[model samples]
Target: MTARVLLLGGTGDALAIARTLGPQHVYSLAGLGRVPADLACVVRVGGFGGAEGLARFLADEAVSLVFDATHPYAARISANAARACLAAQVPYWALRRAPWRAQAGDDWRMVSGWAGVVEAIAPFARPLFTLGREPLEHLNEVPEQQHWTVRCLEAHPGHARARIIDARGPFTAEGERALFTESRIDVVVSKNSGGAATEAKLAVARGMGLPVVMMQRPPLPDAQREFTSAQEVIGALDDYIKRSSNA
Candidate 1:
C-alpha cells in the first residue's frame, strides 16, 4: 500500500507537490476550490475547521505525513495544519514559493497589505488599482470618489468609474509598459502576489517612471520546509523518499 499524506493545498506549490509525490503518496487537497492540474491524487475540498477538526481527520484517515502546501497568503490554514500535525505526531513538511524581488528601475512603493494599499492609494492622484476586482473597491470606494485604472482577468464593474483593462497575464514587460503608457497611469497599485503572472506591472511602472503602491505577502507558519520551483519539488520528493529508505 502507498504511504498516505495529508496535503493542505491551494496554490501552485500544492499542485506541484502533489504531482511530485504521485503514485507513492495519496494527496488530499483541502481547499474550497477546484483542484489544479498538478494535483490528481485523492482530494478533499474546503476547510477542516481549524486545528481540532484537522486533528480528528488525520487520526481517522491514518495520515502518516502532513504537508502544508497552501498559498503563502493562506495563513490560517497553514497554522491549523501545523497544529494538527503536531497534535497527531505526524511529520510535517512545507512547500513554499519564494517571494518576488524588485528589479532595477522598479519604482516600488511597498505597503504591508490590502489595508496599506487602501491608505496609500486613497490619497494618491491618478491611482491605478490592479489588486484584483475584490480589492478594487476597497481603495476606490473611498469618500473622495476617486477614479482608478483597474486591470484584471475579466471586466470588473465593481468600482466607481474604473477604467477597466480586461486582460490576463503571463504578460511580457513590453505589453505591460504599453498598457500603462496608453492609460497615462501616474501611480500603480498592486498586491505582492509573488509570481510572474502579474509582476509585469511593476516593471512597466518602472519603465514609465511611475511608482507602484505594492501590498505585502501574508505570513505563514514555519516548518521543516522545502522551497523551490514546480520541477524542483519533484526531485526533492524523490530524494526524500530515497533517504528515508536508506535510513
Candidate 2:
C-alpha cells in the first residue's frame, strides 16, 4: 500500500501543500480560520487532544509520514507533532518559514510576551496591533490614554479604547500605508510571521518611521526532516509515497 500522509496545517504554506495531496492523505487544521472545501485530501478540523492522542491517531490511520506546516508561532502544535511522530515511529517533516529580518530603516523592538508588549507600547498613543486575537483578550486592560487598532482573522465589537479590523492578508504596501495614516498609528505590534501576505505592514512601518513591537518566536521541537518551502515538502512527499508503494 502507498504511504498515508498526515499534514498538520494552519498557514498559507500548509494550504498550498494540501492542494497537492490525494484523498488517502489527511490535512489537519486547528479550525481557527476558514476551512477549505476544495482540497482533494481528507480535511480534519479541530485538535487531536495532544501528543498522546496524535500518536494513537497515526497508528489507527496507519499514517506512514507526517508533515507539519503550521504557523511559525504555533510552537505547541509543532512540539506535539514531533513527539507524536516519534512515539508512532513515523517520519516527521516540518515547513518552517524564514522570519522577517529588520531592514536598515526599520525600528523593531523584540518582546517576549504580553507584558513586554505593554511596556514597549507605553510611549505610543496610537498603536496598531497585528498580533491576532490575543489583543482582544486584553481589551479591558487597555490604558486610558492610548487607543489600539487590532487586526485579526475575525472581527469583534471592540472596546471603547480599541478598534478591531477583521481581514485576511496578501496585503499590499499601499493599503498598509493608508491604514497607518488613517489610524495615526505611532507604533506597530506584530509577530515575525514571514511571508509576502502580511509583509506589507513592515514596509509601511519602515516608510512611516514607525517602531514595531515584535513578538519573539517560541522555541519549537526539531522535526526528523525540516524544509523551509512548500515545494520542498511536496517533492519529498511525492518521493516518499512512491518509495512506500514500491516497497
Candidate 3:
C-alpha cells in the first residue's frame, strides 16, 4: 500500500503539493472549516480537536508522514500538527514562505497581532483589510471609518458589510494601487503572511504614502527541518518519509 501522508495544507504551495502528490498517497487537509466539494481525499476540517485528539487520529489513520504547509501565521495549528506527529513517532516537515522585508519609502507600522491592526489603524483611514475573516470582532470596534474594503478567496459568509471586492491573489501592485486610488484608501491593515503573493499591498502603500498596520507572525517552535521552496520541501518530505517508514 502507498504511504499515508497527512498533508496539513491550506495555502498556495499546498495546492501545488496536492497536485504533485496526485493519487499516489492518501491525502488530507487538517483544515479550518467543512470539507471542500472538490477535494481529492479525506479532509479533517478544523483542528484535530487538540494534540491528544490529533495523536489519536494519526494512530487510527495509520498516517505514515505529516507535512505542514499551513500559512505562517497559523502557528498554533502548526504546533499542534508537529506535536501530534511526534506522539505518533511519524516524521513531519514544515514548509513556509518567508516574510517580506520592509523597504525604502514604505510607511509601515508594525503591530504584534492582527487584532492589534484592527484596533490601532481602524481610526486612521478607510482601511483595506482581508486575510482571514472569522475573528471580525475588531471591525466592530472601529465602525466609523469612511470605508472598509475586504476581499476573500472564499464566498462571503454573509458575515460582513464592508465595501466588498471578492477575489484572491498573489495581488498585483499595479492593481492594488488602482484599488487604493479608486477607493481612496489612506491606510491598510494586514497580517504578515509573507510571500510576494500577499505583499502587493505593501508596495502599493509605499508608493502611495499610505500607512500600514502589519501584524507580526507568531513564533514557530524549532523543527526537524524547515524549507522555503517547493523543491526543497519535496526532497525533505521524501527523505523524512524514508527514514520514518524504515524506523
Which lDDT values do the candidates have, in the order given?
Answer: 0.70, 0.93, 0.72
User: Looking at model 1, how many pairs of residues clash?
Assistant: 0
Clashing pairs in 3: 31-46
Winner by lDDT between candidate 3 and candidate 1 = 3
**Better model by TM-score: candidate 1 vs candidate 3:** 3
Relative to the unseen true structure, what is the Cα RMSD of model 2?
0.9
lDDT of 1 by residue, 198-221 (tens): 777777777678888877777777
Q: How far is 127's C-alpha from truth in model 1 (Å)? A: 3.5
Best by TM-score: 2
Clashes of each: 0, 0, 1
Q: All candidates: CA RMSD in angstroms?
A: 3.5, 0.9, 3.1
Report the C-alpha displacement of residue 220, candidate 2, in angstroms: 0.9
lDDT of 3 by residue, 1-104 (tens): 34777878778777666655634354456554334455565555555688788889888887877788888888888888888888889777778778877888
Worst 10 residues of 3 by lDDT: 134-143
Residue 221 C-alpha lDDT in model 1? 73
